[model samples]
Target: MKRGRLALGIIGALALGLGGSVVALRAGAGETDRAELEKRWADAPSRFVTVDGVRMHVREEGPANGPVVVLLHGSIVNLHEWDDVVPLLADKYRVVRFDWSPYGLTGPDPSGFYSTPRSAQLMDGLMKALGHDKFAMVATSNGANVGLEFNRAYPGHVTAMAFSMLPLERPSQTRKVDWRLKWMLEAHKAVLPNWRHREFWRLMLEDTTPPEFTPTDRMVDQITEMNNLPGALDRQAQYIQANVRAFQSSDVGAVAEAVRVPVLLQWCSFDDVISQSADASVKRFTNTKVDVINYPDLGHFPMWEKPEKFTRDLRNWLDRQPPAPAG
Candidate 1:
């Protein structure tokens, strides 16, 4: 047999084995109750607000009268990603962070609707519930996409936006995959709802960060427990698919050009996943005052990896901006 054929045979065997294992694991998996998760994750300053019928888990810090700043975490992660930066911003700004459904203690949305547009709507509703009319936004990864969508839908509501690891183009569109192997991806998504292995979460974290940045055991536990929540896996899969559809159907250039507020682009040098979009993102923000800063050593989650530096840089940039009228 040809070497290529042999390699293909091995790949086929591995795929079959993995798929079978996933199905078996899924059969035995059970969902954890939201009430139980709340006990473990929710604490001081944590509150739930009904936004568009979905209960949102949110935290507010700093002075109530201070300038408002909202923090948006990336996909598959909760608001805790900014645990280190919240206090720093809270010193002068009324910093707010929240967990989107299916990702944090917020649990899953009953509607199962997940997309950037929907997230933007939820955000607007959440802000109104909190009595915030306008605010600055610090968003990462998919959250940045939500921020952009929010700004486009409600112009002048966002005074400024700072984005890191912004994916101007969705990965599915950029990384072309063979149609023959697509089912493997689908099977993985199907299996996620039943998956509850901490090692798997640990591996994912390690793969995204530098070798030196070992994800703590607590981090692994948190992620595992969150994903294992009842209905979270299914909702997360739907969210991923919805996001891809939104990106595919919408014009990214139009969205970026629509942004009129001051912008900050914190591009990471080592995040091979989305770094390619960095230069393109800056150029797309032709209508706004965009400040580009490259972190030569950072990976995907720069804020999580170096909160102090991230917060300091953000503060300095924000201080330089002339105060704009609140919405």
Candidate 2:
């Protein structure tokens, strides 16, 4: 009886403390209006289009008649991640970048689904909307998997693909989360209010990138602002909570095997998130010609760390590929 009373008292105290902290912090931490964010972040080429009931924030540049090149950013980031590389490509190929649901100005998906197949479908819909029946793809991390899935589901639409930091784990591997840790994670999500944590991102960037890479203030600020938007944090939390099932069931090896088009693996040796080596990933694509170029000094985000060199290397690869089928 005494122990039960003690536990109840502790729970009450924690609830009161969290509530007080939430009230104190929520003044400046409230969700930023979506329109206000659009005005600030959306540039000249930016447009919102409805795809599968989700209004996607997309940007297009270069000549309309130029061959299309779609850029997909990794998880936790939006289309702005390609800002550095866009200018270099825009004068030549038609450059396209967009924010996937639950990220950037796109916010949460109404359908509440974020599987790789769904992402592939959305990409096809977006490209179709833009009159691109086929295009090349350049993607990183989670986005790279989306590209692989796109090639599998839509096939032939992706004439060529260049990827960096592809997180392709096998279907047989499973992550077992400790029940105590899972409970704590749930508690943390429940008790804490949704808000931007710039310090968390700063630490993450510092830990993930090499010493040569310094995350600029603008990069931190933009990410912070994006996460602070309404429903963004909740959506991200929901996605993270589903990771054990999602990662385990992913058949990336099968997807890679289905690729008949050429592939470029832009590997970052210092990447802390994915495997530092690309040998395993290269072997997975048994059917296709997989060309590799290693960035020995860079980490997860080579484009942000070395934009000019990244663009130059990517442009060279794209130049070598045969032209896509006419739309």
Candidate 3:
């Protein structure tokens, strides 16, 4: 009886302390200085469209008549991931870059409907709204898987496809060797106490790329700001948990064997997330000739780390491909 009373007293004290702290914090943050808050959100890009009542943010450039290139950014990154590459491609292709639903400036899916099929449907609507019938595509990591599913679902719409740092299958060498083992090793090293800490912006930027190509301070700041937006972190966590299966289940070999359009598979030799073995496996299934570009020192984000090389290779590949026949 005495112990039970003591436990209750401790619980009450903790509750009181927590409640007081919350009240003090709220009082200190009253109204939030509207001008300052506005300045903080000032860098967020404008919205392009609202599909199914969810706003989609896009950044478009280049001549309207030029060939279209739809860019799909990786998980946790906004369209700005293509900032360096887009400008270069924009002059040649009508470049359309957008934040996926429930990411970046687009915000979260209020209905909790986040999946590859749903995202693909949203992209289909977005492309039509933007007056595009067929377009080329470039995607990395989670975006690459989304692009693959999109291409499979809408083959008539995607003309050519490029994938960077994408996993091919579940329980493969990459999955077993790269992710699972690495996670365990890192955990043993005490590098991250929790998976959420693994998502830290500084660690992602610093640890996942070539030293020479570390993201600029401005780029890091932009990414971090987007991450801190209301509901952004939660949305990212949900996306990772929900969509990781897509990466695991992706039959890149089957897709490659079935793909009729030209394809490009690029990877960084030192990629920490998706292993090079997976790249080799995916390459084996291509019906059309695969243009494999390998970067030795870069990590998972080769597009950002080696923008010039990636752009040049992409342009060369695009130039060599025969134009699509008219419908």
- Predicted structure with the largest TM-score when compared to the true one: 2
- What TM-score number comes out for model 3? 0.76
**lDDT of all predictions:** 0.77, 0.79, 0.68
Over 137-228, each residue of candidate 3 has an lDDT whose tens digit, in order, gives 88887787677777777778888888776755532343324354356546523532222222345556666676676567766665656665
Which regions of candidate 3 are displaced past 4 Å? 1-46, 170-199, 246-258, 276-279, 283-286, 324-327
Superposition error at 308 for model 1 (Å) = 1.3
Better candidate by TM-score, 1 or 3: 1
- How far off is residue 211 in model 3, in Å? 3.0
Model 2 TM-score is 0.85
Give candidate 3's whole-model lDDT. 0.68
Which should have the higher lDDT, number 1 or number 2? 2
* lDDT (10s digit) by residue, model 1, range 1-327: 699999999999999998787666676554556787777777778889988688899999988888888899988788888888888777778888998655787745667688778888888888888988878888988888888888888777788889887877775344433443344445455555455566566766765666677777767777777877766766777888887776678765468888888899887776766734666778888887789888877777787678788788989988777643332
Q: How many backbone clashes does candidate 1 have?
A: 0
Instruction: Report RMSD for candidate 1.
Output: 6.3
Which residue pairs in model 2 clash with each other? none
1-327: candidate 2 lDDT, tens digit per residue: 999999999999999997887776565445677888898899787999999898989999987777889999988788988989999988878888998666788746778976667777888898889889888899998788788888888877888999987887722223333455445445546654476457656655666678878899878877878888877877876755454466666554567888888999999887756742589888888898999998889877888999999999999999889866443
